[model samples]
Structure formats: structure tokens, C-alpha cells
Target: MRRVTVQYFDGCPNWKVLDERLRDLAGEHDLAIDHRRVETPEEAERVGFRGSPTLLIDDVDPFATGDEPVGLACRVYLTDDGPQGSPTVEQLRAVLA
Candidate 1:
């Protein structure tokens, strides 16, 4: 089974959207998602959290590059449309596919 995790900090507005989208995808794909709350900077570093609402596929961050500074910050996803706070459903679909 694929281990999909959504990492986020508290009070992040974007996480809910990602969570909802993930729930929809999970229903379609019959996969389970782990919602992980990253509470501190040390924990974020230990867990490789780049930002809030990060998606980890099998504990690897598919959306992360090697250079992003890690901390409790809102994340931006690059899409064909533009940089957005949350990734579009199609973008997530491509990744989940």
C-alpha cells in the first residue's frame, strides 16, 4: 500500500483545501492518507517539512526541491495556471496518478 501523508502546521488555511481534495482522491483511489501536524521547527526539519500542506508519498516529498528553506510557513505550488497557495485538483491528480 502507498503511504500518503499530508503535513501541515496549525492555522494554515490551505491545508483544509488540500485535505478535502485528498479525501476525494482517496475515495476514488481507495488509498489511505495520513494527516501529520508539524508543530515545531525542529520537528519540521527532522521530518523534512518544507512548508504547510506538504504532501509526502511514501515519506518522500514529491513536490519539494533540494533548496527550499524549511519552517512553519505557507507553501506555494507551481502549476500551469500559476503559483497558487494550494495545488489544483488536476495537478494533484497527476501526482497521485
Candidate 2:
């Protein structure tokens, strides 16, 4: 089975939305989801966490570039509409697909 991990800080409001979308995506793919919450910069660095609502597929961050900052902060996704906190359902589906 493929593993999906969503790492987020407590302050991020978009994690729930991401979680819901991921759940739906996982259901479609018959995959299980794993959620991780990171509270400190040390933990973030240790996990290579880029920001709140960071989605990892099999431990690989699909949206991250090697130069992206890693820490406890808000994450932005480049959606068709514009940069947003949470990725759209279509975007999520594309990633999971």
C-alpha cells in the first residue's frame, strides 16, 4: 500500500481541509492515509517538513522543491486560481492519481 502523510502545525487552519480531501482521495485509490503533526522547528527539520499542511507521498514531498524553506509555517499551493493555503480537490486528485 502507498503511504500518504500530511504534516502540519497546530496554527494552520487548512490542515482539516487537506485531511478531508486526502481522505476522499485515499478512498478513491483504496489507500490508507497517515497524518503527522509537527509542533516545533526542531521536529520540522528532523522530518524535512516544509510547512503546515505539507503532503508527503511515500515520504516524498510532491509539491516541494529542494530550496523550499522548512519549518512550522503556513504552506502555499499553486492552484489554478492562484496560490492558496490548501490545494483544490482537482489538484489533490491529480496528485493522488
Candidate 3:
């Protein structure tokens, strides 16, 4: 089965948005999703977390461009509504599809 892992830190407001969308999509696809909290800089470095609410599909970050600085910060996605904390449902659908 494909694995979807969402990496986020505590108190990140945007994680919930992505989490809910992911859960809904996972249900539709019969996939599994995992939520991981990056609590420290060390863990972030070890896991190569680009930012809070980082989504990994089968251990690979599909949204990353290979230049994002790894840290415990809020990640932004460029959408039709301008920059947002989480990707749009359509965008997520394209990536997850």
C-alpha cells in the first residue's frame, strides 16, 4: 500500500487543513496516512523536514523543489488564491493522483 506521511510541528495551524484533506482522499483511495510531529531541530534535520505540514508520499516529498531549507517553519504553496499555508484540494489531488 502507498503511505502518506504528513510531517509537522506542534502548534502549526495549517497542518489541520492538509490533514483533513489527506484523510478524505485516503478514504476515497483506500490508502494509509501517517501524521508525524517534528519536535526538535535534530529531528527535522534527520528527517529533512522542509517545514511544518510537509507531505511525504512513500517517503518522498512530491511538492519539494529540492531547494527548500529544512526547518520547523510554516511552508507555503503558491495557488490561484495566492500563497497559502496548504495546497489547494485540486493541487493535492493532482499530486496524490
Top candidate, metric lDDT: 3
Put down candidate 2 lDDT per residue, 1-97, tens digits, no spaces. Answer: 6788888889998888899888877768776788899988999899888887998888888888777798988988889899989889998777778
Give candidate 3 regions above 4 Å deviation: none
Two-way lDDT contest, 1 vs 3, winner: 3
Q: Between 2 and 3, whose lDDT is larger?
A: 3
- Tell me the tens digit of each residue's lDDT in model 3 across 1-97: 6788889999688999999988778766666889999999999999899997899988999899988899889999889999989988888888877
In candidate 2, how many Å is residue 47 off? Answer: 1.2
Most accurate candidate by TM-score: 3
Model 2 deviation from the true structure expressed as Cα RMSD, one decimal place: 1.2
Residue 50 C-alpha lDDT in model 1: 89
Q: Count clashing residue pairs per candidate.
A: 0, 0, 0
RMSD of each: 1.3, 1.2, 1.1
Estimated TM-score per prediction?
0.90, 0.91, 0.92
lDDT of 1 by residue, 1-97 (tens): 5668889999688989888988888876666888999999999889778898898888888888787789899999888898887778887788778
Quote the lDDT for 58 in model 3.
84
Ranking by lDDT: 3, 2, 1
